[model samples]
Target: MGGMIIVEEGALRIVGGLVDGRPVAIVQEADDVLFRVSGNSIEDAVAVARARLGAGGGVPSQRAPVDVPVDAAAPTPSVPPRDLRALLRAAVAAFDPLRSEGVTEGPGKDRYRKIYVAGWPALVHYEFLPSHARRHMGVELHVETEKAAAVTGILPALCAVVRDAMPGQAVVHDPNWVGGCGRLQVVFPDTATADTLARAMQQLIVLTRPRVEAALH
Candidate 1:
């Protein structure tokens, strides 16, 4: 009621592509509502989604506010209470606060809104913006290469390594592909833990960056 979005579940028509910006998606069914949100933990968001989606409805008859909050300064005694997107945005701020999400251009030189943010348990291409957030932890690691296409080759391995490195406390998201570059998110459970692991990753990238640069070149 407060934060969750109530999108009438149905096979909505999605038209326009190639030249037009419309890309259709049949998210849920007609009878049930589809609750999309971003949050620190995938489980937290999913929990709320299930509850809200299960609560049948037409419209609230009242506009509700999104539940996501902001935390400019991170690493508090407790996990920052924010939705998934806000938490990712906070992580992005720690690395490059000034950088704009900017715009995206497609095959036909058509432009649209674009932001480089990490998504997990769900990809941004799937259209997810959570109403609330739990908390997140991870290292702010950025990878730069000559060709963004290079991500295609190393992403799987990188994800695996990052997962193995952080184990359960990880959610690597935000694989940016623009300006001939890409970015990665290496989330951890806490600051100290993430810092130690992030250092190791930094050392590893020193060796891996060259190969990706050379291969892409």
Candidate 2:
């Protein structure tokens, strides 16, 4: 009902309408009462209008549809979650010193098994803490130095630096100053994956070694 074209001697009007549920544009002309043109879609209407007006050089060329590969659209495989104990074992096995010389159990059951860091008085270790329901793991560096106060004093700054570079929280604990011992620990949840633990431990060692060495000096 909307498609209508009115022609006068010097003026013309074109009205738009729908054809088979798709919108169409009506084309008209001035100066001469010529034939009308209609298009099913806006693009078709625009093309018809341009062709009628002698614009856009000529009718627009049609482009061929592109074909996509099936393999390119396929979903990738996901990595399965690892068991806690197995993940911990994998993380411990990743350490170079532990792989070469093996680990030595500490004095008590809760304490970490020591892995010596070459050319330093400090030793690296890993321990698992089990509570009533939850469990936590820690990768720690214990330094044996006579100046316990000096080591503890530099720890805050060192912890700040290490925290910025690492994933887990960095903590310093000095329970027995008489023995000239203190520990710098990176704590992570037991639910963490082997890869995550391994990467965190590696980052902890890299960030902590130079700081502990400087503290000892």
Number of the top lDDT candidate: 2
Work out the TM-score per prediction: 0.34, 0.44
User: What's model 2's TM-score?
Assistant: 0.44
> Model 1 lDDT vs. the true structure?
0.32
Which ten-residue region of model 2 has the weakest summed lDDT?
67-76
Model 2 clashing residue pairs (backbone): none
For residue 215, what is the lDDT in candidate 2? 59
Q: In model 1, what is the error at residue 46, expressed in angstroms?
A: 3.1
Candidate 1 lDDT by residue in tens digits, 42-85: 33443344345542344332323222212111233334443444
The residue ranges of model 1 lying beyond 4 angstroms of the native Cα positions read 1-44, 50-148, 177-180, 193-198, 202-214
**Candidate 2: regions farther than 4 A off:** 1-87, 97-111, 122-134, 144-149, 167-181
Most TM-score-accurate candidate: 2
Clashes of each: 17, 0
Residue 164 shift from truth in candidate 1, angstroms: 2.8
lDDT of each model, Cα atoms only?
0.32, 0.44
